[model samples]
Target: MSSLNFNLQEMMTVAASRMLAADDVCFVGIGLPSAAANLARLTHAENIKLIYESGTLDTKPKTLPLSIGDGELSDTALSVISVPEMFRYWLQGGKIRTGFLGAAQVDRFANINTTVIGPYDAPKVRLPGAGGAPLIASHCQRVLITLRHSKRAFVEQLDFITSVGFYEGGNSREELGLRGQGPVMVITDLGILEPDPISRELVLTHLHPGVSVEQVITATGWPLKIDADLKTTPAPTAEELYLLRELNARTQEAYAPDGLST
Candidate 1:
């Protein structure tokens, strides 16, 4: 029996935020990653350095920014530099600690595809494509991905590899000269996945409270690995729920221009 006071999305966001440490220098993306990063900054990690690709360093936004280059990213930032400096002095220089990302598609090896759904030229749908994921995933000390679990999103092979996770797996990233550790954990709506040390394949390590391993397995496209001693993800604390709700309310307020309810 589990006490699920918060909604699944709330639990997922709070669960993702708890993974970050206060001292971490995080490369922020939009959506779930943004929510989780901001939640961490507000609750436990006040000193977390939030870096944006648009050169906003150490920003503290009360509401979620619409995009990487959103005005709030610079307005609330300690200092805003040029995009070149962000990529050169920060990302390539290895100053960023962890990359918080949201992927469109991922494989067993954690290789990501945010580019296209099908073939390169003739595709089902063209996606946003890789912006800074290639660099961030390769250069950051670690990475954390947030995405809803589904067979379509988690596949045996990615349609297009946009970021390097374990590459071919088992020291493949090391061989590729990637500076970072690649993806450390994948936080899904259902549970958490971590890489196997020997195989470098993602394995289900924990299921969210009230979630069954069978549900997660059904959502995955490939034959997923599960730990023999799997554990339940900690339910969101009262404080975590409050903080996340406040953040969400603030985001809604920011986007509601005409004072209409969001």
Candidate 2:
């Protein structure tokens, strides 16, 4: 497929989608994370169990959900449970394998900040506070973070740490007894970042079709590390693109202002 046919967001979503396996149980977050998780379900990970914080279990939405509470989630879900059961029994009990998340700001260690952009007391941008992300990050067996790559979003220090990713890096998360392994992959428009085996700091492991190592480094707020054996992410396949575009088109139609499909 020609590169022009797909944009960076599509590539990012596809790359993130590929991180899941058919047998995985994914705890999904909203927006980009939700899109990537659903794309995985529609394509490679057909049997992947998708659970939402809103208590929708095994949801297979034909169209992307606008929020956790979106009717489409519950409508297509295998079953609906209470939020407490969703978090306590399923999430904290270690039933979740992959935690798909998005963050407003992410530090070098993959520490997520979705609270405030500036300061906690008086913020430049007040983002939606952490929902189930903290528990999702800490309890799931592993996590996959997806967001646009930029110096602002990829920060040296977050305004506030809403979800712990490796905490202070290294064995810090282990020290704190966080059950999950923390973020295993951080997928972005430019490429993929993985935590170093020893240091636990995020490092550039793969670059997208047209992205460069310098571009990834420049986009990061901190002094990013480059893997010794860097790789290029395979461009989105025709089937992947077809499924993603179809899903998006359906979403637009479902949300059309006149309640009509254009």
Tens digit of per-residue lDDT, candidate 2, span 1-262:
3546788999999999999998888999999999999999999989999988999999899899887888999999999999999888998899999999999989989999999988788989999899999999999999999999999899988889999999998899999999978999999999999999999999899999988889899999998999999999999999999999999999999887864448
Which window of ten consecutive residues has the lowest lDDT sum in model 2?
253-262
Full-model lDDT for every candidate: 0.91, 0.92
Q: State, as a TM-score between 0 and 1, how close model 1 is to the true structure.
A: 0.96
Off by over 4 Å in 1: 1-3, 258-262
Off by over 4 Å in 2: 1-3, 258-262
Summing lDDT over every window of 10 consecutive residues in candidate 1, give the lowest-scoring window. Answer: 1-10
Give all TM-scores, in the order shown. 0.96, 0.96
